[model samples]
Target: MKFIPFYLIFTLLIFVQACGNKQVEENKTQREQVIAVHDEVMPKMGQLKSLEKAALQKAEELQNSETPDQAKIDELKNLASQLNLAYEGMFVWMRQYNTEDGEKTPEEVKVYLDEQLVLVSKVNEDIKAALAKAEVLLKD
Candidate 1:
């Protein structure tokens, strides 16, 4: 009778350990899938950022030119399009920054996102300043 109780206790312990391992494995698999998806997405955002930078360059060139030409206008329009796309990506990232987001690490993701916020702010301010200066040029 004494042996029976000990045997039952040991069996219960083994069952619990098996269940815990299964749960851990399942969690790991889910995390992997999420990371795989985010890996593909981050690069696309990077491309958009590149385009946005090119657009900003175009606007700056136009501002420095003695006379605003047709080419300047065309470049501005192209820059605006790239800026819009980049802004879209920024908004999407902001929306997901708080959630699990399938990101690599929550802490690392926050750092990346905070840096992006600063960059985006600077880009927006540049666009505003450019527009203001361009308006003055157009008036004169």
Candidate 2:
């Protein structure tokens, strides 16, 4: 009978350990997802700067023209602003993101990662939208 009680305790311990491991794995997966989104957009930082500069240069050139199109100059300037905003957004996200678990529990870590994924995903969208708009504008 005593041996039976000890076996039950051991089984419970094993189950608890397994659950903890699963939680850790889940957190790892979520972290990876956040990083994936960040990686997708990070390479575009340089492009964003280049596009912003190009937009400003085009706007300036238009402004200097004898028959300057004020409307087109305004549009190019606006596009430059949007590109700069998107570029800044990435830096802001990187500044605020924390990868350390510190004293947080697994559940807390999961929540933090979830929030980060949402933020990074939004940043990704902003980057893509700005890049697309710039491309369309500069193509002309």
Candidate-wise lDDT, in order? 0.56, 0.96
lDDT computed for candidate 2: 0.96
Candidate that would win on TM-score:
2
The per-prediction tally of clashing pairs is 0, 0
**Model 1, range 28-127, lDDT digits (tens) per residue?**
5654544444443444554455555655666677777888677766756665564565447456644654444364444454455555555445544444
Q: TM-score per candidate, in order?
A: 0.43, 0.92
Model 2 bad stretches (over 4 Å): 1-6
> Every model's Cα RMSD, please?
11.0, 1.4
- Cα deviation at 77, candidate 2, in Å, is 1.1
